[model samples]
Target: MLILWICFLRGARPILFIDGCHLSSPYKGTLLAASTCDANNDLFPIAYAIVSAENNENWIWFLSNLKELTGSISVTLISDRHPSIIAAVEQVYDRDRHAYCYRHVKENFCVETKKLQRGIRGEVKEDAKKLLDAVCYTHFGTEFTKAVEQLRAFSPELANWLETKGDINKWAKSQFPHRRWDLITTNVAESFNSWIRKERTHSICALITEHRDKLANLLYIAKLEMTKWNNEVGPKIDKILMEHVARSEFLKAVRYGDHNVMVRGSNVDVCVNLLRKECTYLEWQMTGIPCPHACAAIKLLHSNIYTYVEECYLKSSQEKIYASSMIPIETHDMPDVNNLTLTDWENNIFLMPPTTTRSLGRLCKKRRESQFQDVHVYKCSRCDQSGHNRSKCRNPNPEKI
Candidate 1:
């Protein structure tokens, strides 16, 4: 993991996503992870630890080790609004570098809004929720202000709740530090957790070995995959640039200076400053790729849009990230414990599985369905009735009966 961290430091962005997953094994525990994203926006697991639970003490231990590993490099950490994580980050890393995951915020906001409007009439609650989402998604301060004003007009209490929780600079793209780019969620960590879901149930030693093997294979495959890339940037980044280029077709650009231009879309006008790599919409600076407005300006000036993209997104950097190889461990590589002296083996006997209280019910393997997830209803073609498929329908055909 330390070697992986060294490679990541050489090529990956200085952004980290931290999260903890509950282990469902006989000896229950928490799998705390620190992860980052590759140039292609893929998961890059850096470090992990197994702890008894997700408490402040355990989080502090995990983060302290991470801090030592990452050194004093300035990094932006993204995570859910977990109190333990918040406290640990405050104590370990610079508080200004932490950003709350927007997805978690939305989920928590929806749950709170439902409780606040338990018996309210009309669709006011739903409207307020939608407006809150708009506020979160807005990339410009003016648009954010308008959205908040609309929410206030609908419900001042809801607006106030959002304002109290939503620190503009932490969650809003317009005010967020541009170094972290447009990553707003800790999905990179979540994705890595999902990738190792089955392995999470293993014993601590087995889990570590599994992760070692998995990471080795992932790096090897990534190295081979990136070698074939022909573009200046990664595939995902190139696709985004192409999309912005397409959008630039609908925008009109007027030059004011050598590096400044005004781009007019159908309904809005944005100022693009190529020199600073900033646009009035904040997309260019936030994403490290030119927004449609900047794309228009670059096109008008006959400049290479690729030159404006951040160097971290280049294919060469991605290759350098996976250039280091992870040696796979084999059984023969293990030392013979039977040959060890009594003193050597006795001291290691204290290490044991974590202690946890057993729950009352059967352990659930599947995740609980989200409240917002659409429930699919099976329709019976034979009787045109919902909730039962044709094959499972109790109603028989008259002729067959």
Candidate 2:
């Protein structure tokens, strides 16, 4: 909590990826966490709590605790469309900044399309997926509408499901109101969950202390890495800038005014205002990096492209974000109760864990992995062919042809 307060206040963006994962043995509870990205585009965990279950009440409790630190400032919280999470965010924070993770929404879209399939084959569901993918990636309203119309062409019911179940403004990149950058999922938070699986098998104290140690080490590594950065911007931002610079080489920039430049080439006709750091495509504003159009304009004026980037993507911000580190909590000493008086021992009440019944199934200690998600294709050893094992292989017969 101390590190979160100090580092986040100084640097990291006001965007959180909140998620919950089941704690394994020793503490059978749900670990709810709030994490955000740093200037280097890496996972930076803020806070976590252990709850008996993932429900509306627990989620509210978690977010409420988080709200105290965040204060009244609006934050862009990206997560799945969980009913509990949706309800919790609406109550804890304003719903205007709540954005849906595109991946989760896409998974839901796949679900609805599968429902629409209804054992049908050769229905061109791939085309439907492409349309939805375009909608998710597009930033322009016209492009989004065109993509949605294409999706509607595939099936009106499927399109209706997307509109009704998934909010276009929340999940669509072109329509999202906040500065979420390129992150569209809770992947970092989920990575945190998976990273601590072995630690979850230990006692609660050990699990927490281990988390601190890992974060402390990570920060130290980041500090060392920061000294090596050659560019003014963070590594990720530098890569993006160079890529934009290369792409802008094809376009021709014509000065319209003191700050405005009209860029045209390869089907690109857009306006770039170097002074305002804006582009007609809106990519520069949304991503905090100069787009190809803006880069072309900057090149025309012989100005530094890095000057157009937002301050949040710079090395200073990255350093401030990782400046604070957690001190390891040593637990070598344990207070012995043998010297305590009998009266003192009798005065204190120690409560045991609550009684619980094991559910009637094989206990799951990790995430629910779909069996069909990673099916292996068998190859025949005898014939040196694919798709069938040696036992099941039908060897080619020369006489049969």
lDDT of 1 by residue, 1-401 (tens): 67788888898999999999998777788889989988888888888888888899999998899888779788889998899999999999898899988777777777767776787654766776688778877886788899889988877767787778656567765556545688888889889889999888888777878888888989889888797776888788889999999989999999999889999988999899999888988777777888889899999999998899987898867977887898755678565657777886777753477766665899787898766669998977778778887788887552232
Whole-model Cα lDDT per candidate? Answer: 0.83, 0.81
Candidate 1 local accuracy as lDDT? 0.83
Scored by lDDT, the top model is: 1
In model 1, the worst 10-residue window by lDDT is 392-401
Pairs that clash in candidate 2: 139-174
What's the CA error at residue 139 for candidate 2, in Å?
Answer: 1.3
Model 2 lDDT tens row, 267-353 = 758999988888888888888889999999999999987778888888889888888777766656744567667776687533223
